[model samples]
Target chain A: MLNCKQTTKLLSEKQDRPLSFRERVALRLHLIMCSGCTNYDRQMGFIRKACRRIGGDDAK
Target chain B: MNSERDGNTSKAAELWLQEAEIATLRRDMLRFAKLQLRDVATAEDAVQEALSAAYATRGRFAGRAQVKTWIFSILRNKIIDQIRSQTRHPTRSLTQDDGRNAEVGALFDDGGYWHKAARPADWGDPEAALGSEQFWVIFEICLNAMAENTARIFTMREFLGLETAEICTELGISENNCWVILHRARSRLRLCLEENWIKRG
Candidate 1:
């Protein structure tokens, strides 16, 4: 069982795209169960997007 | 006849080359290996060994992953061997009066005061700066500062876009272990960039 930190870290590493089916389900379940984790996930997404933009690898 | 056998061998080789289309991928692999080894000779040797092994055992590749992934797996193994062999003997001590140490040390102040480092005059939008050379420099410094194994895993996965399963297989690491290494690498990199680049803006 991965903690929120681990889960969000993996999410951040993934290239900009929608999560896989399993990931979507897992993330949804985690968000429903843990508000703190959900916020962390959102923050991670924001940072990743910002990094990609700065790195000039922004998604089409 | 011998002529027929020669023709068949040529045809087979040509077909394999067509199927593999390995030249561009080979260049990328070589560049990656060079970065990891930090020496041209060893990096080239690693690439050659990997290509030879891949050629001899090409049939083991099941085509599940992309061709680049498969070749990268072979190259990763070669690099691991190189790293292990290099580490087997006592190398240059880090405490030497080398300029390399001084340079890296200066990047961080006493108490690891990376937070006090200089910043970009205008970091510009984080989105727009991603493509700038500064990000890559910060990225390189952060990556070079990580532990060897951790840096290898991150480079293989993040820079090369390899799958976790492939990284584990090639690096002889468990899935969970790979994740942990990658986790640490990313967090450290994030912290480094925030302190050095992000905050500079």
Candidate 2:
């Protein structure tokens, strides 16, 4: 049972690399029960997309 | 006939150069460099240097990539050089552990769970937000507000699309430390956006 802080950290790491099976299972189990971590994960993805659009024309 | 073909080839090359010049938007490059370097004058110098380099190497451009992409690659190299030089100086220490500690402390409680007030809120229509010009203005503000090294690491990974291993090599930090920095950066940025932009709406 990964707590929200550890779960959010793992979510950020998942953006950079693939998680191992155990880590994946833990995050999934935690996310299923925790809306805060789930929202954090979604917002992190949103921020990454927004960042990619920072300087240039977004149409491309 | 051969002379006519040679003339056409030269014309094509000339047109490509003109298109490249038109496609390189100075303001956009400056914005990106400022975000990465966090210094207005240095960002201007970097953009200037990158443009000159692109102009000098225009003859070698194979025209496979878009002109903007070509210019961006040159700018990236220039920014990386600036980062390397800045890091080599002894006046600026690489280990700024205090900011990182405070950031972590603010986010997590004694039991290592998210502090009650630090929990994330739902950000509505993030795709739409990305398209909005005002959202980006706020985004840049939040990004610029972050600590220098942390912002650099975040932009290097997200904006520049560098792998973690590549970032570690370029920044000369341990892999674990790199992850820690990235985690903190994301957490801070997320909270900033939620409080300043999403929640306000």
Candidate 3:
């Protein structure tokens, strides 16, 4: 039900951890048929993890 | 039995304090600090000093923001202090009219232009790329490319774990304006990295 922009924002927030029930359902519904947003989600997650790993090295 | 209870209580208290300690917030705090000071050692010292203050005043940490966010607020103050304390004066003026600046015109044409900024890739498969090492290069390049102030704001909100409200309060900007600055910073970074790192390959 969420638009691509909202979906993308939620996906970014979810990257930090598990999504809430409403968000989980919304993301599932959105990704079920929307390839672009799904790809966006994946990319966002990748960037976050990459940055965190880089941060991990700096903390040492 | 009483002694055992007291020992357990002490252990629990220690763990609680450790969880709220500044070192626990290092990953993001240092990143934010480095953005300001531009030197890793100086940034680390600033963050360490902020953490010490936070520990001393841990009770003041309103749970409204994440622990990382609270520590970052302290770090910001510390960085400002360090900058203000620097007593060294510049050896030479930075006037552009000096003959030494005459060569600068060659970097651009008579119309005044530099290299066209890069654009982000279409992000063909974001899911597959997330958590990849190559992505870190993009992240670093994009982050570093941002304006110092923009980078500070974004790093504080996203990397350092502060809420938009807290950031706005500290930076003395409106809520909507804070979001705007963050958005611009992210977009610029995305475009810069897309052009430099992704397209190059």
Candidate 4:
């Protein structure tokens, strides 16, 4: 089982590339039990959305 | 005939830089400067200077988009000049990630478990925070707190919409290095925001 440290790092890496099938399954399983990592995942999604919105604002 | 010709040029200048557009454009310039310069006060000063310089040369501005591009160029130069004039802050060094990783490492205990105090709380309706002006102020503070290279890489990927391979090529760093920097930046930003914004809630 991946530890929280590895789980968090993997979640960040997921932003830059597609996680392997096994990796994805492992992360999903981990998030099922790890509330902290689950929250981290959602926060990452929110941050990404925020960045894109602000970046789009610059064009106009 | 000469008065009529002068009238055409003045009208074209007015169309290129309307009074209302200047207010919107200044905000854009200020945002750009703050991201790069990292000091809000300095960023505002740079934008002010750039706008003044652009105003002096406003007659030459050709179109709306052209005026934006032109003023942004001036702002970039102004920031570069400010960065050079000051004794460089060591924190601005690109290789500051090692120090940042050390700080991140402190958050986890030896078996790689989240430390008791560091466990992230569920951020209820986090997107709602984005709607407030205060939220952006805190967000900017968190982004400014990142390591120098990490901030650059993060902004390039997140803000500039650059791909991983393109970033690696542009920065002449290895692909692995690029991912490492990005990962570090992402994690840090999350922690920073959670600490400052979510925890406050």
Candidate 5:
């Protein structure tokens, strides 16, 4: 099982590239059991959205 | 009648150009350039060059993209040229430095879990942050606070949406090191936003 630190690292990495099937499965299982990691994932998504807005690249 | 209509059409085009608000466009271009170049003087030069290029080519703009988008693309090319020139000089490595190691250590415990105090808190209504100019002000400060190379990598990925391969090729770093730099940048930005903007009420 991926710990919080490892899971969060993977979560951040997903923003830059697609994850493999095995990596996705591991992350999914960890997120299911871990609320903290789940929240971390959501915040990461928020950051991506906020950055798109601030950078004005959302139109592109 | 045909000659008169042509004159009217030309007049409207002149009015449209007059309405483009060059000053605001320059400010926005400077903000983006500074973020990517991380140097005020270079960013100013890039924006100046881009604006002039835009003016010189205004007739070919064709109105396909937003005015801002068109200018931004020009500025993007300028930034790429700057990056290429810097790479040729090879002044420094883009890989992890000692300070980055300390930053990475602070986020993880010996057991490889998020350090208790370092874990992220729920940031309610992320849209609120997006809607406020004040939020972006703090966000820019946080971005500038990061290591220059790390900030460059992060902006290339997040702001420019460049692929990892492209970023590695441009910066002359390996794929693995690029990912590490991005991870560190994200972790630090997340914490900075949470403390400085999200948690402030």
Candidate 6:
């Protein structure tokens, strides 16, 4: 089980690069059991959504 | 491309902005400039200079819809000019000396768990928050509150849309350290936004 700290760092890194299959599996497994990290992930998504609006890159 | 430009020229020739529209656009450009230059007077000067340049070339612009983006790119160059002129030494390290380590450290505990007070709250209807001017005001405040170098790197990544590698090369920092800075910035920004904007709502 990845702890909150490791899981959060991975969440940020995944934005910059593709994660290995093992890393992705580990993250998915950890996320399934952790509400806190799950919320953190969702909040990160919200931030990116906000970024898209500011940059006007939301054509999709 | 030349033929395309010719077609655009014919279609776009009649799409010039009115004086009133330029006046309104100045406010948005000023807000963007103020964020980068961090000085209202200097920001105004940059925007003024860019607008003057824009007016000189306004006849050659593509179309009404793209004028906003076109003007922003011009303003971006002017802001960069201001940044270069004002800073005697612009580069800084991400791993040390920015003083964010202690702040980010405080968010986590000895065992790598979120500090009780640092746990995130649910930001309900954040899309609605986006429509609020106050939300952007809070965001600007949050961004300006970050360390200078951290904010610059973040702006480079988010506002300017520079890739991490390009940023690393330009800043002369390691890829690993660049990621660290970005992570630190994001963590602090999210926490600040959550506390001041979302939680209050």
Residues B1-201, candidate 6: write the lDDT tens digits. 357658876554457677788876887777777777778998899889988887789878756877877877888777665654544454544566566678767877887877877776767667787777899899889889988887777777776667789777667787777788888888888888988987776
What global local distance difference test value does model 1 have? 0.57
Pairs that collide, model 4: none
Model 4 CAPRI quality: medium
The per-model lDDT (C-alpha) reads 0.57, 0.78, 0.57, 0.77, 0.78, 0.76
The per-residue C-alpha lDDT of model 6 at residue A47 equals 77
Query: Candidate 5 regions off by >4 Å?
Result: A58-60, B1-20, B89-91, B98-100
Docking quality (DockQ) for each candidate: 0.09, 0.62, 0.08, 0.51, 0.63, 0.55
Deviation (Å) of B179 in candidate 1: 1.4
Report residue B144 deviation for candidate 2 (angstroms). Answer: 1.3
Candidate with the greatest TM-score versus the true structure: 5
Looking at candidate 2, what is the lDDT of residue B164? 86
For model 4 chain B, give the 10-residue run with minimal summed lDDT. B84-93
Candidate 2 per-residue C-alpha lDDT over A11-48 given as tens digits, one digit per residue, 9 for 90 to 100: 99999888999999999999898777889999888888
Q: What lDDT tens digits, residue by residue, belong to model 4 across residues B120-153?
A: 7788887777668778888888888886667777
How much does each candidate deviate at the interface, measured as C-alpha RMSD after superposition? 9.8, 1.9, 9.8, 3.0, 1.8, 2.0
Residue ranges of candidate 6 with Cα displaced over 4 Å: A56-60, B1-14, B80-92, B97-100
DockQ of 1: 0.09
In candidate 3 chain A, where is summed lDDT lowest over 10 consecutive residues?
A51-60
Backbone clashes in each candidate structure, one number apiece? 8, 0, 5, 0, 0, 0
What tens digits encode model 2's per-residue C-alpha lDDT throughout B1-201? 357759977865664555545554786788889999988999999999988887788777767346677787788878877877776543543447745558656777877777777777766568877656677788888898888888878888887778889877776787777888898888888877887888775
Question: Which 10-residue window of candidate 2 chain B scores lowest in summed lDDT?
Answer: B89-98
